[model samples]
Target chain A: MAHFEKASSITEWLDQRLAITTVKKVMALEYWIPKNINFLWAMGMVLAFTFALLTISGIFLLMYYQPNVDTAFDSVNYTIMSEVGFGWLWRHIHGVAASVVFLIIYIHMFTGIYYGSYKKGREMIWLSGMLLFVVFSAEAFSGYMLPWGQMSYWAGMVITNLFEGFSPDIAGGIMNAPGLVEWIRGDYVPGQAFLSRFFMLHVLLLPLVIIGLIGLHFAALRIPHVNNQDGEEFDYHEAAKLYKEGKTKESKVIPFQPVFLSKDVFVLGVYLIFFFYLVFYHFNFAMDPVNFDPADGLKTPAHIYPEWYFLWSYEILRPFPKDPGLIAFGFAQVAFFLLPFLDKSDTVAPANRRGLFKYWFWIMIVDMIVLTVMGKLPPQGIWNHIGLVAAVVFIALFVSLPWVTKNENRA
Target chain B: MKNELKILGVVVIFTAILYWGVEPFAHTQMHKHVDGEHFAYSDLNESTKKGNVENGKTLVMGAGACTGCHGIQAVAHKAPMDAATAVSAYGVNPPDLSTAGGLYSEKFLANLIENPAHALKVEHKFDAAKGKMHPMPAFYGAGGDKAQEIADMVAFLKSIAPKEISPKNAYLDACGRCHANRYGKLDQLGETPTFKSETDTLKHKVAVLEYQDKLKAYMGKLPPDLSIIIRARSEHFLETFVENPQSQLEGTSMPRVGLSAEGFEKVKAYLTQTGDPSKTAREAIGPWVLLFTLVFTVLAYLWKKSMWKDH
Candidate 1:
């Protein structure tokens, strides 16, 4: 047991039992952040804020939403939008947050890669973040099904059909790919059973998993501290001692509280301006026009596409024949998790400092953008050829990452 | 500081490129541009400009025989038979002509009265194998100069229409016969009627089923409910489509209902109301929220500077 002074304040009384003071010191007041980091460091906090917004707004929507296929469309478009007061505000917040969260995640991801944040001891941070991304993707897909609209039905049909690739030929007979698809849907096609199960996953199961992974992500960050722009190392214990001795100017670190938090608050304020602008004025981009129609399994939309966030991977799947395309898509999903091992370079430096690695990084970025652009276009004429080339470049870039960085000089 | 600006510049340029590619360029590729010639209802508009309203009313009530099947509710002209009788006899209930003048383009109305199949663009529906012609007969032979008489009737119908109609009323009058507005709580027969007796309730249910079946048979397939049509289609597509169904979709069972420019606006207003009721409120509050956030951002910047002054 640790010695303590007599209790005088509420914090002291709680500290005796819960060690509340120690927790504050460990997580906030005494936690040291490198002084050299920039505004990109605030992206994690932005993502967390977005997740909180999504959770709150989603709860309000859930109050009026019907999980049954027969009433789902009416419940959203009529009951919530027209009957409930200020219901549209909640929906707009949820819609904008769902979309903007992905934007922040992508920025956060590229920031990590640029600073070599996944090098050595920081692998768990990157891995946990990737897990969160996968779960969030699943959550978005499930939530989209709750609307029971034309796009929702057809996108669900298209995505669920991807499981057919799991079935393979054995002994000159087809395996039960059709059975596997039916099992996931709980029927031969997406229907009442499918809607109910997706509602359960969206509202309950996936959220619980996401919350758990968020905890792990933050925990992973605590151990490695945070990566900085310069990728420089310091003796944190000595830096903290200097910081505490009223020699703040000489210290290489600052406390996570007032010094770091002030910048984060400023960034958050800027981000909220952008966010609410979308929520109030430009919300249509987040909503697909075709989703307004009631779901009819018999009729397919003239063009079926996923939300903008999923476009790059969707493009990868489009350029090849069925089996090879599935393989490419699977590779895209799992490739990021293997990033810590892919770049064999010893030094943890920014891409610009590394010779050939800089070109690799930029080419990879441009290729992804090309893939995203090609994804939304109808795969015909020049677009089909462009998509195929972009997809191939995407695969080749990742496969060549190790070789490109192996011969680079240390920073 | 310089590095941050460089990064910001890169982000801005990247976003601009993505926006251009996904929005403007991709849109042009997906939907081909329709020629302006399709929207020019020229000849019909010319005839309608010269129409005589009094002459139109006399012809509509007397020689036209429109009151036999269709009702002119604004002029107190009722169809001889009720809705149930008409559905049984002709396979679908004929729409009342209370707002036809304002609801349809003048050209569409003239063309429709002259040649029902040609104007409706359902010449395919007149299947010789099925021994079926369109339910309504052409008032005049397909090729003739009955433009003046058609223009006058359109003028009479337009004259009796209310100067300002509610979007809900406009939707019901123009599109309610074939299409249901489920989001607005409207069916083909308008609001569902309440019954005092169980027998009457059962009778209403049976009647609705029979009406739907007959309508399906007449149109080949049931017309899609118009609850979300506003969001599902672009404004340009809807305008050209309503002006002439064949201009967008050839051989469609839908007739050129020919709403005057004003009538189509009202119907579109109703659809927008049902589909996106919060659009006005959302846009109204947008700037205020942005202003508040901007002020907060400025204050936060000042606070950050003060906090970091020592370090």
Candidate 2:
């Protein structure tokens, strides 16, 4: 032990002209991480780690994949079914990690929202996190077409076609322009063009924007005090002074030495086991075999669904009748991003709500679940219309939340 | 620590089972095939020649394997090609039989099938331009009633041809798609063959080039590339070959291509050749490829840097 310290001496410091250990501390330390964070709080870490794995796997995929119609499907199959050592595992991991990343991010956001983590002190961080969610979603959307499979082809067709639903005149012009339509198609339809452009966007562009936002999110959050379980902001100086005074007495600081660190490691290990299970055995996670066929623009996939996590949001948007002016759909759809604003009440606890707000919150949750189920099932008539009515009514309730809260506080 | 270790062990075993042990059960969703409904084999007959196209869908579905070579559009089936892998595999033009009746009368198709050589008009502009077209392979080797069956299929195609369009005009329209002024370039309108319109260009190119060897020899001293030869050959030379192949040169091995007088004239006038400009320039080669590579590399590097920078 004496020799171990002696070997790490002045000569090593002199060679660099500064302590080498300082660089390690700067790089490796998570100084901004909340000390009180529990297993639920670890979702962000898991997602971040998964993002890294996805990036690494994505690099390998770019090596052999071809995007053109003739070779696009064949090349992906070659990668998965034939070429490379255990290429199927790589494909499965990349695919599952996509779903997993969204899942974790959603849970993290939900936790943050419920805890009022976006309260004035951390609004910028919350806003950045929300923006990152959208960026990652677009990344997933672009990446979906990279497989050039039946689902990828048709889903891309349906979604890109929605840009037309925004402005028919513009959509018609864009759809008619040989070059523009071809560009949207990745050329002529689900073949090389779609696959190649989507691959570049997925692997490079989306990740860059997401990472930058995530950095800002953390930096902004660091400047404010982290919210505690009791919802009281920590006055760090007062807390530190009290802790030092109590050090001679029976003090309480969760030590990094054994107890909490070991617990975190154990939880992480369990989480990873779940992660690896999905990666290896449940390799078929959400990706359909039929999607292995190249995209034919004329032939839409019989059933179109978004990634599973977005099924709730996609469900909410589905119910509005197409004939209604854009306001109906636009208002219903925009509610998701506007959720942070909608749920703004001084009270974070659900149990304390005196009147309709609590019931409405439960109704919204149920509506979301119903929409999620609807997102998976094929469209039906009267029932689907009823679902849409419910969505509209719930949206109204959500929109009126701030006013309702003000009235209740005055009473 | 012991409880933590036990929890960790359970997690590992659970994960291992979930990852490696789950049985992959096969499930077939009610996926609708793009091709239509099936027909029974018992429905096969001479009368089946007038069969419903909807019922003929089974001929191309799973186990039918018809989709392999024939494209989704059967009448205009062209092999799909990737730009990078198989540029020549899908030729610039393929035959269009959308309006065959206008280009060749029913009797002409019959005689042509029976004897390709006698039916073809031999063109021998010079001895070098005298390569006979390979005899079209018989639909049934050594001949039988398969000829009639093939004729029936041709009739089926003819039935589907749009009522308003002529074969020559349809062929012209197809040709004028990429080469807008193909027929307009023919100086000697009466002497040279040309498409009446752009649509029939593919049909004319295919029919004219069907005599590939003869066409090659005809342009021997001029441009070597077929793409370019169409541009170089004068209206008169092209016209003579279409009008009377054997009469133009003695010892000419060229077979007559039984084109109607109007069809022959239209195709000859329309066939202008041009070479792909990219191949001839040596200096542009390095820089063009390098430019794309640089852009791609720079984009890729920026992407990577941005993605990992935050992490």
Using lDDT, give the best candidate's number.
Answer: 1
Q: Write the per-residue lDDT of candidate 1 for residues B1-311, one digit (tens) a residue.
A: 69777886787687678767766677778876765344456534344356779977877787446777888888888877777788878987888888777667767777777777666667777653477778787776213347777777777877987777888888988888788877787777786677899999788778777777878987888988887787777778887888767777777888776677777888889989877788898888888889999999999899889988777
Q: Mark the 10 consecutive residues where model 2 chain B has the least summed lDDT.
A: B35-44
lDDT of each: 0.84, 0.50
TM-score for predicted model 2 compared with the true structure: 0.52
Give the number of the best model, judged by DockQ: 1
lDDT tens digits, residues A1-411, model 1?
788778899987898989898999999999999988888899998899999999999999999999988999988878888889989899889977987898788889988888889877999999999999999999999988888999999999999999876436643435336578889999988999999999999999999999999999999988788988888888899999999998898898989998899999899998999899888877766777788888998889888888878989999999998778888999999888988899898778888888888898888888888998899999999999999999999899889989988987444
* Candidate 1 regions with alpha-carbon error over 4 angstroms: A1-6, A170-178, A409-411, B35-39, B43-45, B126-132, B141-147, B194-205
Best by TM-score: 1
The sequence of per-residue lDDT tens digits that candidate 2 reaches over residues B1-311 is 36435534643453333223111211112221122111111212223223233332333221423233233343555434321112133222223444444454444544444443444432233122265442242233123354454455446544555655543353353333222332233210111255688768766565444433332334332111122233233334445543444444434544443455555544443332121122223234435544554555455445534432322
RMSD of each: 2.8, 19.5
